[model samples]
Target: MEHEDPLVTAEWLKENITAPDVRVVDATWFPPFLNMEKTGRQAWSEGHIPGSVYFDIDAIKAGGTDLPHMLPDPVMFSSRVRKLGIGDGNRIIVYDQFKFFASARVWWMLRVMGQKDVKVLDGGLQAWIDAGGELEDLPPVPVERHFTARVRSDLVKDANQVLAASEAGSHTIIDSRSPERFSGDAPEPREGLPSGHIPGSICQPSGELRTPDDRLKSADELRTLFADPMAPTISTCGSGVSAAVTALALARLGNWDVAVYDGSWTEWASDSSRPIAKGAA
Candidate 1:
């Protein structure tokens, strides 16, 4: 199957929102530190693209793990998304309220689960509004669709694999956290977790991958940002969220082989046995 572009514009989404095979997903999420009054679902309930469903990353995740939003087992994932009316032969477009934030995470999740034809909405909900698209408070009642989860193990990495990559240097470990957090200069948002990144990992803040308007930067700019774009890479961030942004950026550069370290800093730093490196990479 020919791979589609990893991103879609609001204009395109507006035109295709009502298509039978198109599924629009609102994947908006905010950090607990933000203490936002409205949850992603609340915001979506207030107003969202017509015919769109909400995917709560926090709710649908691996069980028996304290780690936040770890990828659920294939059976669980298939069941969850199927209930959301996301299934085979559907073109899924994911978007977040904070422009380019959490949508990429959902996109990465779907891709990891072997769902093809999935894309992130460029610039997110704001872009939709900017494009003169309308929002609706009434949610659609969708019939369950048959979603088969084909797990792509290569697209997700665990703490052990990340450790191997860090120690053996087999893969380029890209830290998507802010420089301050990556360098151990700032405390982590999660209580009791020390700052500092994995040894030999390079810092590339996910925020830098986007334009002022929240759209991803041009391919040339991304190529410059990732000096060695073709290298085998693993994206990591706070609790595996922003890591997807890094993965999305790499995908934009036509590099789809990048894997996301699901545990990321949260799981890595929690274990005292793991080595931590401070300062710029």
Candidate 2:
């Protein structure tokens, strides 16, 4: 895919929010830490972008399996997206509260569903507020949207492919985990999961991609972060969550070739049979 740098800054969005066919999606999702137990949804109910639809990753997902928020079946996804009032010709903008968090997941889902014109809001919500932007008390009632699914298998990888890539060094597998978790010094946030990282993967915690106001860093800053030229360069994190944050940062720098390991370290660590490395890659 010929990817373009299509970010709309908080200022940019504020100036042209009423623009036609420009749809904003609140793709906010968080781990248990932020009390994913309650607040994410409540926070949105309290305030959000007017005319913006909540693109709940947990909902409208293929979630029957134990695998965390995996992509839904194409037809199922198509229907769920249609319910969101999103259509083929619309320009989609995704954002979230946890810095870059789940917005990338929505972006990736759109790509898999074959929507290529989507972009991420640089800096997300914290940036919006710091910039003194407006907020909406009631969610927008968007017109029904029609969407098509473009399942890009090449853009997604499983544990086995990642393992092979690890040994071959065919691509850069950037782990978007904290230095502590990456170093195996601190256990995974998810209970019972093993410590450490996949062999050959580099530690590039997702936090580095953000600014003081919680917005994505500059293009030059991001480009220098993932300076790998290998094929199939990708990212991963616990249960494939924060990994999407890494993908979004890469996409902001126009690095769309990167993919998220859907089965991430959670899956990799689940099977003790898989090889593991400690300290550094």
Model number with the top lDDT:
1
Q: What is the lDDT of residue 181 in candidate 1?
A: 98
lDDT score of model 1?
Answer: 0.91
lDDT of 1 by residue, 1-281 (tens): 21556999999998888788999999999887889998988998999988899999999999998999899999999999999999999989999898557899999999989987899999899999999999999988988999988889999999999999889999999999999999999999999999999999999999899999999888888888988887999999999999999988888877888999999999999999999999998
Model 1 ranges off by over 4 Å: none
- List lDDT for all candidates, in order: 0.91, 0.79
Error of 1 at 211 (Å): 0.8
In candidate 1, which residue pairs get closer than 3 Å at backbone N, Cα or C atoms, i.e. clash? none
Question: What TM-score do all the candidates reach, one by one?
Answer: 0.98, 0.92
